[model samples]
Target: MKALILVGGFGTRLRPLTLSVPKPLVDFANKPMILHQIEALKDVGVTEVVLAINYQPEVKASHSQISILQLRLCLLKKASFYFLQVMLNFLKEFETKLGIKITCSQETEPLGTAGPLALARDQLIDGSGDPFFVLNSDVISEYPFEELIQFHKSHGGEGTIMVTKVDEPSKYGVVVMEEETGKVERFVEKPKMFVGNKINAGIYLLNPSVLDRIQLRPTSIEKEVFPQIAADQRLFAMVLPGFWMDIGQPRDYITGLRLYLTSLRKKSPSKLSTGSHIVGNVLVHESAVIGEGCLLGPDVAIGPGCVVECGVRLSRCTVMRGVRIKKHACISNSIIGWHSTVGQWARVENMTILGEDVHVCDEIYSNGGVVLPHKEIKSSILKPEIVM
Candidate 1:
């Protein structure tokens, strides 16, 4: 079956990082966010994928089979143009990483969730009236797609939404389903008071018939489309039995990385931890390096190609790929992004997020603030820089 991935959002919440790359391309557990979704869809026998893109057409082009092979890399000595050439080259080199046929549907204007379906309606549907899968690109899940499809077929419902129970019903649209028939009774979008625990999990197995109802305009499936269909008693709910994380906010994004890293450690224990001085639950990638006499762990993750200098101490922190932590530095409860460097004696704590290429100079203190990508923090005193 075919799948549609929505990738056109502005991603205003994940600023600085999103300023350079799209939200779907953001790194989680050393891999692009959307790649996880793509891999999951492929596991469920999805053959084709359509990317709804606007900001970065190059990302879509680089992943396509044709562009992956044919795109050429050109290098020049000029500093400004050299980086451009490198990007041009990689886009050419890594095509066809996954053999699925990828087609990107670009929107000239901002098209809402249902609007993209209307735009790609012709490509997504055939005369046979097959059910196509649609998933939000920003979420990470191990939900059983095959079982969800089976549940949809058995019920013979017009539309089946994959739902998961959440503790905070106020944060999501709570779905009330019939206990016996598995039919969707109704949905209330983020009710001020709690109504039910089941919330929409951002996964849907949609029927082709439902596409006929969505008009060619800016519309949301949750706010505009699904509720109307529920009045006709055609929508159904299928409970999922796996982990689901929506990487929308900063805290959830960091937690999602922890969830992914922790899962990897469980599957292959030998793959995560190695060397002495590192203790407790931790995930260290094969390419990462932990210096001698360094203390780490108790819920920590060192990503690929990271280097921890001698006498460094880290706890409950996630260090991304290409990071370099100098000697005697102490880091706790923080996420240091790719290629960042922490100078000796630097102290990072209290949920600090250091973006790509960030340099925290010696004896610096950062707390409760996000450092934007490519920024340098060298002051000895703590400063609260609020990102607008």
Candidate 2:
């Protein structure tokens, strides 16, 4: 089977970080965010992936034949495109490492959720007459792809919308399913009143024929297409067990990091950091350098090439690749992004998010501060603010 991932749009909710890089390329658990979805699909027999995007990179002015020799990504709507190139280039390595072929499609204009399926129709549908998966790049879950496939086969529906139970469904597109037949009845998108607790989990398995319901225009699969399928009595529902997280904004992103780490510890303890006195669920990459006397734990992930000096304390934090945490520093409930450095005796906590290449000087204290890439934090930040 094949899968399609929607990786378009400027990620405004995740600004600064997304300002420097595309949302799909952002690191979560030391891997690109979209790779998690790709890996999940691969485990369930997906052989190829289609990355549907709209962000276009332009060539530089001093462009020469040598420019062709090097892959350089320029600005996108005035934002950095270097991360865009990294995203495209990484597909080569992903194809080789994961044993799956990847294809990319760019949209000339903005197309809503269902339009991409129509745009990539030739690649999605063929004589094979099989169903394909559509995934939202933002949602992360312990994917039960096989079970969804089996359920769809038995239910014999044209499409299966994977749903998850959330405490408040009114904020999402609430899906009402027939309790016995598992057939979808209707959808209530951000309903004013209580409709149902089961919400669209942003994952779907649809037969290629369903693509015919969409047009080559801006169309939403939820607000426009899914209703038609439900009216035809062809859309089924599958409620997956375990955790599902929508890691869009900073707060949810940090929460998702903890969820991911805890889940990993349960499934495979070896993936997490080990050794005597390890505090909690931690994933310290093999190449990371941790000095003696550092206390790390209770949901901490040290990415590859990270350096932690002695007496540093990290809790409920994600330290990205090449981050340097000097001696006697403390971090909690925060994310230290790639190539950032925290000076000695600095204390960073309270949901702070430091972007790539940030530098926290000695004795500085930061709390709930969102520091942009390449900024230098020299003083104390006691309140939440954005430093650009």
Candidate 3:
């Protein structure tokens, strides 16, 4: 089977962190966010995975017989291109490590959601008449891929979208489907009136024929193509069996972490950390060093090479790789980015997001502050704000 992930362009919703690292490469629960989808696909017998990326690195043409020094200077001048090059290299490594054929479908321009399918049509249709999976890069869930495939095949529809019930249907595109048959009747995008509670889960299994419905230009699969498919009675909806969250923004990302950890506890309690200082579900990488006299969790993930000193308290937060928390620091409901350092007696709470290499001085208090990369906080942030 094959899968296509719509990675889109720069993840502006997850700024500061996405500014430094590609959204797909950003660590979530000690692993890259896209790795979760890739691994899930691999487990379900997916052999080839295509990443539909909008941005293609534009490296200048190399002059023949150029010196190594000149190449270094060129790379230094094009730092963004260098960063993209590094990200691509990591994707190549993923191919080797996972033993899957990973291909990049680069777009010349921003081609909304549906156009990528038209562009990558050849790769998806291998003459087997098999359907391929399409997913948005930001969504995280249990990923019942095998079940989805079974349901899609049973329906024999052009496309089957996984739908999840949400409380606020007005905020999302609702999927109105037949209760018994699962045939999608219509798609109502943020309806002013009351509609169905089920909304698109950003995951779809579609037949190759569905690509014909899309043009080779900017098009929305949800807004444009889906309605046509539903009108033709060829679209179906499958109710998702587990938790789902669009972790594109920081707040949703944290909430998703909590849900993920809770799911993990239910499925594999042994994977969760258990100690006297551990409060609830906590995931600590083996390389992470947690000090004594510290209270951690009730939902927390400590990534690789992190150091937490004694007398520290952490709750409902993620400490990314290589972070250092000094003694007597209290952090809750926050995300401490990669290599950040929190000094002694610091207090960080309420969705505070510290970008890569950020530092908080001793006795500093931060509340709902989004600090950018490579910054130092000397004073307190009493309210929610972006510290650029």
Which candidate ranks first by TM-score, i.e. highest?
3
- TM-score of every candidate relative to the true structure: 0.84, 0.92, 0.93
**lDDT for each residue of candidate 2 in 1-388, tens digit (9 for 90 to 100):** 8889988677777776786678988888889899889998999989889988863545546545535323433434345345556677877888989999899777766688889999999888766888999999999888889999999899888999999998988778799999888899998878889878999999999999999899999898998999999999999999977888988887888889888888887888888887764797888999999999988888888899999999999998889899999999999999898899999999999889998899999999998999989999988999999997
- Compared with the true structure, what per-residue lDDT tens digits does model 3 show for residues 331-356? 99999999999999999999999999
lDDT string, candidate 1, 61-178, tens digits: 4335544323431111132233334333433332366666666675655568888888888778866677988888888867578898898998887888988888888987799889
Task: For model 2, state the Cα shift of residue 321 in Å.
Answer: 0.3
Return model 1's CA RMSD, one decimal. Answer: 7.8
TM-score for predicted model 2 compared with the true structure = 0.92
Better of 1 and 2 by TM-score: 2
Q: Clashes in candidate 1: how many?
A: 1
- Segments in model 1 whose C-alpha atoms lie over 4 Å from true places: 54-95, 126-128, 265-270, 274-280, 381-383
Ranking by TM-score: 3, 2, 1
The candidate scoring highest on lDDT is: 3
lDDT values, one for every candidate:
0.75, 0.86, 0.91
Model 2 collision count: 0
Deviation in Å, model 3, residue 26 alpha carbon? 0.9
